[model samples]
Target: MSKWFCILLIACASAHAAPGAAPADDAVQVLNDKSLLNQIVELQHNVAEKAQSKLSAVGQNVSQTAYQVADSTAELVISSMGFLGLPYRRGGSSVETGFDCSGFVRAMYQETVGMLLPRRARDQAASTQVIDKKELKPGDLVFFNTMRRAFSHVGIYVGDGKFIHSPRSGSEVRVENMRESYWLKRFDGARRVAGTDAAATPPKNY
Candidate 1:
């Protein structure tokens, strides 16, 4: 009944008829043409149904993946938050001993998502994929040049333009605004873990 179906029928009928000859009035021929049209219409309906089903399945998969990523990110951020006020030890990576900047970032990822990151700040930056500041999401890493070098310090971004890190010697792990004057001036860049599902396999060098 669609315009395309009508056009197809006309095209088929024209092809079957001889050039410049009138179509035959044979009853058998009419029945055959009708049968062919019905088959074609049924085939098109089936194809459309299959295509729609496939699209629906793909949409659901995408939504489920996105939800998993968001859930993983929330868990990582919440786990990091629980470590607030822990002392900043120079090379520490545990609750009993405390943690340094990169150590804290590495510990949270390992604990929450089972993903291990590079030990050093610079190495962590090199191992992950680079992303712009505006593209930062919860669980992404934010780098800073705290010690006169790129990526000397790292932290886990907790969204809303804020990050949590273990500041130097006497300070403890705490959240700070990236928009603050000192932080903004020292901001190096942002990097995202390779996988959205928070199950990224570290690179050989990572």
Candidate 2:
């Protein structure tokens, strides 16, 4: 064959390479660049999708947090109510042994919210995040100076100026109205568990 024919055959063979056969160096470089570009485009698309997913998850968290306060309060109140009729005991922390006012408050929070509060009423008051009575939610604590001392008593505020507590030695766990003259006079303050006000403050990004 002529030289020209041989060159034409080689060109055709190069253009129509067999499956998985090694390509010419120039052709291989062009294919590699095209494959690399496709991979880059796929990576960019994947990154965008992942970012969108994260933003969606964050939005869901904000929504859940918005309702968390009310949910937690309701759960706490429900748990406290479950202990009604249990007799009072000094420094007691369980229904089996009975419960003091502070112990009742502590146990209720621990059971309902998985949070450990200070054992004594006064210590709990000092350690918690104080809030005005007007800001009280159902699960917030209401302090009282029943023993002629600051924070001698504590109760879980159950909304509408109502609270649940284990009264004195003779009484059992009970829910009472804070508006009653007896409780009103001794009302010291109100407080919230730290970081439980997520509903009031939402994430800035969302």
Candidate 3:
């Protein structure tokens, strides 16, 4: 198994400490076997094949930013996974300083895809292309009304009904099930950042 996969397993092992919560082994299986990792590989392969064929046919007409390939999206997901245990900090956006919900999402997009998103959760939601829940793919943005306001929190969707984010103060960056009651009720909407290239649109000033 890959080193990152081991790290993910370890993180999941420690993630569910509550007495009635799902078993750590079960969480590990859900995250690795049933969800994110496997889905990423499949998504990458499928998109790579499609991109190759389309590129051969259209040549220069294809805009890299206009249509994102799965490779970049997979990279984004893997990159975010590397920070699984990073601490949360309000208004923070770095390893040293930690990250907030929106800050974590912004940092991932900026670092991996060269896309600079709006700094706050609401602004990020307003700026991106609104997408249906059924249309959500790896690397898309998922918003939540955690603070009793629409789009008050944000995370990077990593497939299989899960998303990764810096949850709140005292909570480190972690992946959570969107199907869970708390999150399910608060889900505001989903959005997609269309570009994989560095020339994505500039973030609007908040």
Report the number of the highest-lDDT candidate.
3
RMSD of every prediction: 27.0, 29.0, 7.8
Ranking by lDDT: 3, 1, 2
Report lDDT (CA) for all predictions. 0.68, 0.65, 0.72
N/CA/C clash count, model 2 = 0
Model 1: ten consecutive residues of lowest lDDT: 197-206
**Candidate 1 or 2, higher lDDT?**
1
**Which tens-of-lDDT digit does each residue in 3-116 have in candidate 2?**
442344345435433334444343323223432223223322433454455457777565455355445654565456555556788979986687999999998888767789
What TM-score do all the candidates reach, one by one? 0.65, 0.66, 0.77
Best by TM-score: 3
Which of the predicted structures, 1 or 3, would earn the higher TM-score when compared with the native?
A: 3
lDDT for predicted candidate 1 compared with the true structure: 0.68
Ranking by TM-score: 3, 2, 1
- The whole-model C-alpha lDDT of candidate 3 against the native structure comes to 0.72
Write the residue-wise lDDT of candidate 1 on 1-206 in tens digits.
Answer: 35676564445444433334444333123234443334334433443444455457787666455445545665676456556666789999887687999999989888877789999999999999998776765678999998999999999876556677888998777777788999999999999987642322221111
lDDT for position 38 in model 2: 35
